[model samples]
Target: MEPSNKINFSRRSFLKTSALASGGMLIGFNLFNACKQDVKMPVDLSTLNYNDFNAFIKISPEGKVTIFAPNPEIGQGVKTSMPMLIAEELDVLWDDVYVVQAPLDTENYTRQLAGGSQSLRLAWEPLRQTGATAKQMLVNAAAAKWGVNASECKAKQGVITNANGETLGYGDVVLEAAQLEVPENVTLKKPEDFTIIGQGTANVDIDEIITGKPLFGLDYKEEGMLYASVLRPPAFGQVLDTFDASEAKAMPGVVDVITIGDKAKAYLESEKPNWTAQLSKSKKVVVLAKTTWDAFKGKKAIRATWKEESALESTEFHNEKLNEILEGSKFNTRRKDGDVKKAFAQADKVLERTYEAPFLPHNTLEPMNFFADVNDEKVRLVGPVQTPEDAAKTVAALLGRNIEDITVEMTRMGGGFGRRLYGDFVYEAAEISDKIKKPIKMVSSREDDMTTGVYRPSTKYKIAASIKNGKVTGYHLKEACINGNMYGLIPNFFPAAAIENYQVDTANYKSNITTGAWRAPYTNFLASAEQSFFDELAEELGVDRVQLHMDLLENVKNNPDPKIEYSPDRLQGVLKLVVEKANWGKTAEGTYQGLAVYYCHNTHVAEVADIEMNNGVPTVKKVTCAVDCGIVVNPLGALNQIKGGVLDGIGHAMYSDFVFDNGVPQSNNFNSYQLIRMGQTPKVDVHFVKNNIAPTGLGEPTLPPVGGAVANAIYKATGQRLTKQPYMNNLQAKKVVG
Candidate 1:
């Protein structure tokens, strides 16, 4: 695992840190930026007055302020919204504040990741305190200059004004403020007095993104960086048998063909349970060349043979197994309140139905790619990694290098629904660079990203409900899914404790078609199945759909369980808001409505889809969504996430599915996969509940409810109960009679 090349200390140090002491107000969590501690700061440490700010704030003498956003920005708007939180409490003008994506520095910023919609939730308190501390420091500086009490000075929009009307801008005081001691305690602004948080501020990166600036990982480049294309096993559960790269080596611009064996086992075994690394394991041959096109051409020129394992199973096999398990498997009880069998026997009526969701690919707009420069001394990795710390761990372990020697820098990702969470691509680039003794940039083509990537496992849900005295008194859910060992966090789902007699059970079937996190994970399938069944139960009882949901929520509210994770009040809050906004009871001309609600990631979201059949095809005309994610960080960003999640869910429900045959994915690209197009997207109306609660994540909570909403709406439009995914497939199988 040792690198062949030796490194020089002076040159390596320059690449590690940023330019820290260029004569300005430099504030950061870490002391080392562009040089080692042996090199003293350009300014005197005493004159520079450094207080203990957690991380990420720098003010130039000329009034330019930069705040480094700690988390990765995978189209979640953290880069813009997080900085707004800092600038808002600091009382700085929006125009003067600039944002930068912070490099991976675990010592300074903890949990610097983008997943589970938790970036804002975890950083809210510390970031607010950081900004408030800076503001207090500036005020203290001004008070010392004027020889007045700090309380007498009022600060707003980067300026402090005294009782006598003497004003000093933050820029003017920053140099002197840098010399003042940071306050031990500072009060944050009340919600009623906020200016930047609730307001609809546009994303700061919009101009750069629109103008085609080099921000994404695919756009990254460096001097002497060689391009690489990895050739993966043709199918899942297959291994590399042999490869003849002699033809590829002779090609123009081709440098080397290196094979990366399974280096993930050691890293995964060291951890308790690392499903991300487990799913990301792959056996591949990397073709290195001068350019991406050359690498691609070289990969095409090479011929590799793969050996298919006998245990490999296909999608059809999995579907059959799921059916078998659902029909006869003894389900392990995850959550149970009452005897399901006894409750069903005593009920006036019983309704049972099965729902299925196929395996799905992330299909990120930018395929997996990473750049790595490694030697015996240091390992430098730069790419679109959602989990930087995890990626660094894998790289360090694989290369047998010190963790400190590894530096992971994140670039803006084109899209990572949840795909980039696995640092497999980062490791692959590092491994290739180490073996080849050169800097490498590994890229996965659209085909490689789609076919070889970890997919959202196929799932089956068998739900039964019992109606006694005109009310659903009992509920049972039996889930059988694939890749249960990998991403089985939530065993029991919402409404489990809502009913008087509720029983939840699950059974997992193992599969080799790697599955990891996909948006809201299991809720993506569970919400559709649970809500659809609830909708059917409502119909059987002759109750309005929305009213039925409200009644169940009320049941939970009246007889609350101590173990209930979601608040019935919050659930009802969003359901009522969505119904009111979507005109639930009224049907528009040529349109039918459907309702769905679910809670996940400590956020409650309800959505209603308005649909109309266009030439035998169900078309979503409009959608109304109501969210209760506590406080809104940026209204514009939250709304965008809500709208995007709805559209993404609708697209997946209506069209997306990945089918495998003989251990190979049948759908290779967009042509066969069928993604929801922009023209087919429905008009969406978003609303958020006003509350004093701290902010939660909005990126994923809005997606889970969408499938159920659309399915329920389709049932209203066509009177056909579609139980399988890609609802269009079921709709197409039968023509609606005129």
Candidate 2:
């Protein structure tokens, strides 16, 4: 049967109920910000209508259950952990649940972007309830069938057994269970009764990944499907003066050539500052061909002129400007109750320093790619994307059809690192199908994937503290937030944090550059700056940085302020654990190490990085992390996330970043962009703290501290302070500054 070029909303809306969604937690968002929509139902799930039942359950007549998680896995191992939540209450063997990736429908989806470590933090409660409630519903149906009270039934694995020795599989009760009214509120399972949650389990997808299943978008294929490639700008904002599709389009297997980019009908009001019509602004030549090589040939032969434009101001320029401004100490941005000025004025010693970092890319293993099938009737998209609802809405709007007419199928992403969350790349695929009037697969080359992608905004942090009697009398942090609008990335914008007297003054030096999230986003910079500065100050006062943080934390705890409301329990937990676990202050002969702790993505992680120099190059030999996410779903998966974050941070510390000159990046591919390799892989040991509380997230919170840890370790090993990253070139500057 041929699918209509048009997607039916009936099927999209039908897949709404919660079930085992490919064993991973997923998040979903529509493309446009102003679009408001009612909940929709899809007509088919696995080619059958499945989602109209509720937010989290689909029971088969034969007893199998499907879960619909709203967030992307992105190799963080949600494919195993998130499912453990529902499986705990469902009382089913994990194998009994069939996991399918949720279709893109926002109403039933959670915050679909899998960043900020909120995957388990946000999904833990809802998913657990979904499981328990579904079980209770099934029990209610079974009770009615057996003429027994629901309390007489007990669910174990996939069967319901009564005290009378009668038993029936879930398949026997699901049809009747669906007809029963869902109770107003179903009592969830207690921890004591949980067999799956709070217990160690291996990742469900490990076998799949090892076997090389075609779960990722790059692995997706279709018969007679044409491949497409795009030629991007030389640098950001380097516009195409002219180009011809004639010669390249005639190449072997080349089907069509299309120019793709963001076409803003009008500059409507948006909080997003630093917005520019850039060469990197989603514009490209879509190369359509019969094979990947054919697409490559057409892409290689394309010729275009890159327009000269004013690039972003130099990092040095902004660094100096921010330093000068902070020296004036004009910060009222957010302050706690303190006479910090008077304290600083009376102090016998005053110290301050400026820290800065350049923009960096999230070079995920799997580059950006998406497949969209659009005909005159309906639109369907499949790829490894963090955003499905967003992609669907984009295709619908671009196709001039209703949002309900688009279908988005999310495939497993190789890695997110906060890059795949941007739905812009998905729009690239939809635009090609709409233009070429045929189903097409769009793939970005490694070059296009890196240089053309958005990045973590480079930032400069200035901090000062006044010391008296070996104690900090006054402290303030003035951060020059480069882009004025990284605030729009919030998923639920609730909760509060600690820290005060901090002014994040943003200035836009909008160049032809594009920017997006990378890991913890701004928190990575903030953690390195704030935590590293604390370490420096501790050394100045002849105190341990870990001890100093504990002291400050004590003060914060006693006076709990609203401006910066971090998890009090977590803050204290990681600090103590790291110190104890790493055998802090223990002798290691001549080895010097540094420590840092940070809480983000609902999880708190503290790392101790042991460092030693090998031929003047900083080498990290060991990393000890104390992670607390409440409970363990898949210990191995959680460990993998922590290890990945550390390696990623190591890359950022020693060999990641674009060398910009005259508005163009000197380094564009992996050869120039240094990522961590196996030779440098440190011994990473992760220990999750024992707690009965809910599990948070483990993806990104573990990253921020690795930089500070290494920086501190370098200082210990060489009686030198290294303030900058890519430890080679900046070593000179850091030594001079010290």
Candidate 3:
């Protein structure tokens, strides 16, 4: 169940507050404190009138409000939308507010990271309450000056008006508000009353982004900072053995050549499981130079030899191992319900299919880069990172310094997509700086980023279903992947409780290739496989595809499982909404349509892809999507996310393929790799399910369903099942029956 957004005032206590140096007010409070019954003693606002509070809001003397957005903005629009939550309750005009990225402050913020799409979902209540409480404090101050009951005064658009119609700007009573005791509770604005939210607001960084401002990590620079280009092992199972840097040291503008990562190697050898540890390369050769070009040139001059430490695994090897695992019965059962053996034995017919996907690189627009200055006093790190707290912790551990001694500043990321979450580049920058005792900016070429960066795990799923009396009696799903499986995370997702006899088994073949989250993670491919399987299932049962989904959802709703990870009502809502919006089952003469619905990252999304045959090839023309992520914070940003995700999902499923030859990446650059171009992008029509429930994530949920919709649509147009990713490749390999 979704948590209530209603604020409980009696149990809440303000944390800190201060009068701004610029003759304004600053308020800091922990919204989570409302959950605690025992209220802590409020700090004396009068004594703590200094400008050092970890405050979210700063009201200037001119009535302008600067809201510090506390989450990393990786083009997810949190920098703009998160502050909207505060400004909405603060009763400030959207134009009167300015949003700024907050620094990494564990004391003042929670969940500063940007993965999992949980930013807005987790911040919904507390951020609203923070703004509401500040508004109430302003109201109290105005009421005190006017000699009227605080309840008689109402605040709107940064102004307070009393019963007699006298008005005081928020700036006018800033000092008094700073001295006033924080109100334990404040009334929040209803959904219908929201003016800034639910309305289309331009992204806060749109101007800077379009104007080519220095907002990305690649644009960050400091005087006297050296540039670094590192050479790592060419393959996954290889380790850096030795390197001769004399020739590189003699290159033009080359400052120094150093080797680092001994400490990282020791840490990895300790057998301690850590996300950062998995990212760290045990040894590397860094070429520090006066310029980025010089660094690159020097790096090219270095001759390094690597020693094989383990099997040099390739894509063919991965495919063999995965297929072997799926074919074998030695599997760990993730979930089992009812009697699968009996149901299958008594079944009249059985249908089974396997879906396969290759490993994928993040391929972020901006290659990995970071700036770090490690001095005896403190460590200053600045870059675009999804997980600043984790990066800081990793740097502190590597440098043998206290985490408090490190400060991290987040720049707007060009694109993360879970790549920057690892912070491998950040560690390298800090390690290089600590070794040379000078600030350094570490940058990775596109080849370096693609060949050596962490990747999305390759996976295969075998789904089997038993049919009796034209109804699915038993369902079994087995997943085989490289490095890890999704059983622990999504065992109770859709299709778990919908079927009477359901069982999920998972097995994995551990490889030396590093794999981590990529966008929606497992669901990015799982949804495609599951949705395509459902379409095939519908055909096998001689039922309408949409009707089959409705039946399964109805089963889930009627016999609700407490452990089910999705809301049947919500899932059904999007499915029905999309069906109506997209005019499902009705298409033009040349257009064939297919639909898919999925729930993940706390959001429910439904998509319908419209495809047309062009020269015996299925081409996507348009995509209609419906999303239920609770209340829409910024319609414009929400629309951007939907469209971007749809296009990204379609492009990757149709073209993005990453393979390895003996652990060496075959597609390192765009010359060999393929991406969807503007001409190929389909028109995406996005609609949202109107609700007052607290907002959920939108960044990733919209992506996971698009691949399924596209694949199913291709099947409808070509009469061929696409069981492999890079659907274009698979489609071309098979005859197109139109």
So what's the TM-score on candidate 3? 0.95
Which has the higher lDDT value, candidate number 1 or candidate number 3?
3
Top candidate, metric lDDT: 3
- Model 1 C-alpha RMSD vs. true structure (Å) is 7.4
* lDDT (10s digit) by residue, model 3, range 668-712: 899999999888899999989988888888899989888899999
Q: Which stretches of candidate 1 lie over 4 Å from their true place?
A: 1-54, 262-273, 278-283, 485-493, 732-738
> Where does candidate 3 clash, by residue pair?
none
TM-score of 1: 0.92
**Per-residue alpha-carbon lDDT of model 2 for 1-738, expressed as tens digits?**
111222222212222232233221111112112112354323334544422322344566566766655557787767677778877877888877766666555544445556567667666655665566667777887899999999999988979988797998887876566556545455666556678776677766667779998788999888767888878766654656677778897787888888866542211122331222112433577789998779988988887766654454455654555555556554435433355577678888878877777788788889888898878787888898766655565556555688666777778898888778776667667777777777788888787777678777766666677888887777655655445325522211111222322223333333446676778776776677667787888878998677777777776677665545366667778879988888777946655678988776677788988866676666788889998777766776777788888888877877676655555666778777778878988898788787667676777878887888888887777666666666655775322111
Candidate 1 clash figure, as a count: 2
lDDT of each: 0.79, 0.67, 0.85
**lDDT of predicted model 1:** 0.79
Q: Give each model's clash number.
A: 2, 53, 0
Query: Which structure among the candidates has the greatest TM-score?
Result: 3
